[model samples]
Target: MNGHFPWLTVMAAVPFAGALAVAVLPAAKRTLAKNLALLVTLVELVLAIIVTVKFSPDGDRFQMTESYAWIKSFGVHWSLGVDGIGVVLILLTAVLMPILILASWHDADGPQVRMDGTAGESAAPRSTHAFFALMLAVEAMVVVSFAATDVFVFYIFFEAMLIPMYFLIGGFGGAQRSYAAVKFLLYNLLGGLVMLAAVVGLYVTTADHDLAGPGQGTFDLARIAQAVSTGELHISPGAEKAMFLGFMFAFAIKAPLWPFHTWLPDTMTEATPGVAVLVTAMVDKVGTFAMLRFCLELFPNASKTFAPLVITLAVIGIIYGALLAVGQTDIKRLIAYTSISHFGFIIMGIFALTSQGHSGATLYMVNHGFSTAALLLIAGFMITRRGSKTIADFGGVQKVAPVLAGTFLVAGLATLSLPGLAPFVSEFLVLVGTFSRYQAAGIVATVGIILAALYVLVLYQRTMTGPVKAGVEKMRDLNVRELVVVAPLLALLLVLGVYPKPILDVVNPAVDDTLSQVEKTDPKPAHPIQAPVEQAAAVTPLGGNK
Candidate 1:
């Protein structure tokens, strides 16, 4: 927490070190690489916990902040900090990494089963070393992206995440791995390019100001936001809105809103379970997070102008994703579509522009990660065992693997936001907050809950219930190691469901700060009026009172 310790820098570096080590290790030392990566992630998790403890609930300023001049000529600095929301997300990034690594124990080092039922014949047999190394690299980039306080720094960290993940899909994914990876890469790259233009525009605008004087501009996010919040910085309204759209366009693509979401299912379907969980559950969150941090905070006026369109899209995504999920035969692809549906809810919560909605969206991020992890990992277990990822390939799995079926049921229930589960609390908050502002959108999004139930339960019933399928009679239940792997995630889902106050305490303050930054409030209802009979009659100018 202290500047003296530089924990933020250290935390980000640990995974990089692990990745470099794994990258250099001999091909035979796959165990060493995996173990080292695990050790590094464990350490990162501890540091994330410590960082969380250091953050005060009442504080609005970024905590554990560090700053130093890095590129002096460009006016860029190495700056990082964690607000309550950032810390929780950083914790999520760290927590999910180890769980993913553990779950990928056997899968990472083996050939992935493609859509056609053939094991991928990559240049190498299963290479755990490369897999773990890339995983660690992805973790490092994600951490910095969450913590970055410099605009250019944040953008760089933001785009840097794509490298390790690109290889993760292309090198160790399904039969169509290369295509999926290319699609994911190209989409993200386009978003980044637009954002880069915006970043450059911001610098130029800042430099032209009298305060900046001459040619000195800065890429400090804090300073820029502060300038905008006060009356000092003045870009033309048109320019500001344009810049806002430029940045928003990037996040929208990243958020994979509506038509932008096509690449996600393909990429997720082609990815391994670990990769899918990392990208969809954790990494994709950056989109929403940046929208809150950058789009709303830096462009309050533009956010107001675009709120209606964004909410409309969020509603569309909610329904579209759910309907697609319902029709999916591929289980992994189904998981991807389900996420798109859930993300709609998350986006709606954010733009709802209510404190309750903002806080709920934040909590939804954490809850969705845990829920998705359970679904993906457990489903992966079944697919790996059955030699297929198709839902039709599974039936009556509970008859053979009762424990697995039961766990899947719990995960499915959580996904649908069943009462007494973590997602229910967050999803409820999102709905309540959204309804507080936009009644019609809230009502429409509510239908997604029912669609969610139908998809989740139907998937469960089709795959886990009924008579045992011909080749699946001998499918094994979750073993002891598997239980160990999932127990923590399940426990979290339950504990947070019952006791979300601890997280809310942290998230609420950040939400309040965000609402303050945007400076918008829910519309007030008109007061009902009652008048004397004579006064009422006088008011009826058009016709005489009966």
Candidate 2:
């Protein structure tokens, strides 16, 4: 599959082509545009599944590889490949795109209705074609980002994605959409600028040191990572640290860790739920994923040097996000804060630098995407019904709409990482892995779990448990279309929660490879387990000797 077929290229290109086609469709063909976009995503999803099926976890570190010389002068190539991490994330993106399209079916149509159920005549019209087309464009860019083995290629799309997303937020969002969209764009653009400097610095360093070969340089991630691993490329500690900071600053803001996280709540608060899902669940994942692929692999020594500081920041984010979530009066804002907390766990696991940690972090990324989608999309539906995003606007939702309230409860419980839910397995693995080496940090991170319970349960109680609010009296249950969007997500949560081995099988080998690249090994247990024969022999011998 490496060169026989252009799987990765096709996967990215289909949606890009679809986006073009959808964007150009006549405004009169709005439904056709939506159908065409959904069809394209479904086709993309099928291709992704084929790639996943063909992927051999035990085979090469990067499979389905495709490379062609794109810019000879710059020593750049259009290279695409996927390790286990990329495979799962790509699949996650493919799965979510269609669901989001369906979830946002009517989101871009006309102006929003007022809380009194009156249509707002003053609101601006939204273009459905642009909305769906922008979403498809985002999918294409994200797929490319995941599969790109050329650092230059990756950076190009990484920054390019912000364009479509800016429009998606500002064009199809709420009252403060313009403000939120600007803030999101500015924050990420600043991060991208910083990353561009580091990208250039890396290319220069490779050229100066001849990391590729004598009198040559390369921007291929695999080649450079191999050079670093084998000691063929020796970057000075100071230069590596500086480059690491440059790359890290960008990803941190993308990951939205603690202080850098200010833009997210505002962004999600204003964006349509589908756009919110795209930003938080799928788009933001690129940041954390880059940390694993770029930061750790490309700068292993710097990774080791800065692991503690990174872990500390992650722990703080966990606590900070959870605490804010507990206090949020706005439903969307609350979910946004919880995502910040979840990302903290993901980042902490990545920096923990062990097999379990890495594996859990990767799995957590996938699980969080689905869980967040389920919760946020459902909340969006509720908000549409009540014409409000305030937590206090609805009460006794379960009494009026049992199915909706039930699903919301399940999604909320998953958010709290309750036992027997999708997030629980990933979160547990993260703690176990982090506790193995960074005990104090792990211990503090658990406070997030307690806080998560407080927020999730309190939210459920306030909205769904008490007597019905005045407006919620006639609230409807999950409609067929809405159920189509949510059922799969919830099913995945349940399936993965009890049996995470399938995903683990795919990610574990990659995690091991990453640990090897960084020269990390899991910490040994304090008390080793003895073989049964040894234990029996010791017990009998002790009795006889006594």
Q: Estimate candidate 2's alpha-carbon lDDT, on a 0 to 1 scale.
A: 0.93
Q: Could you tell me which residue pairs clash in candidate 1?
A: none
> lDDT by residue for model 2 over 1-546, one digit each (tens)?
354889999999999999999999988898999999999999999999999999899999999899999998788999999999999999999999899999999998986533333556775567889999999999999999999999999999999999999999888787788888899999999999999999998998888877666766889999999889999788999999999999999999998776789999999998999999999998999999999999999999999999999999999999999999999999999999999999999999999998889999999999999999999999999999998889998899999999999999999999999999999999999998999999999999999999999999999999999999989999888899999999999999999999999899999888998889999999988999998988887684544763
Give one digit per residue, the lDDT tens place, for model 1 in 1-546: 244778789889999998999889998887888788888899999999999898898875688888988898888889998888888999989889888988887767666555454765653476788889999999998889889988899999889988989999988888898999999999999989998998889898888874345778888877878788886777788988888988988888787788789889999998889899999877898998898888888788888788888999999999999999999999999999999999999999999999888989999999999999998999988998997888888899998898999999999899999999999999999999899888999999999999999999999999998888887998999988688778888888999899999999998887887788788875565564555885776575666554
Measured by TM-score, how close is model 1 to the native structure? 0.94
The weakest ten consecutive residues by lDDT in model 1 span 115-124
Q: What's the distance in Å from true for residue 249, model 1?
A: 1.5
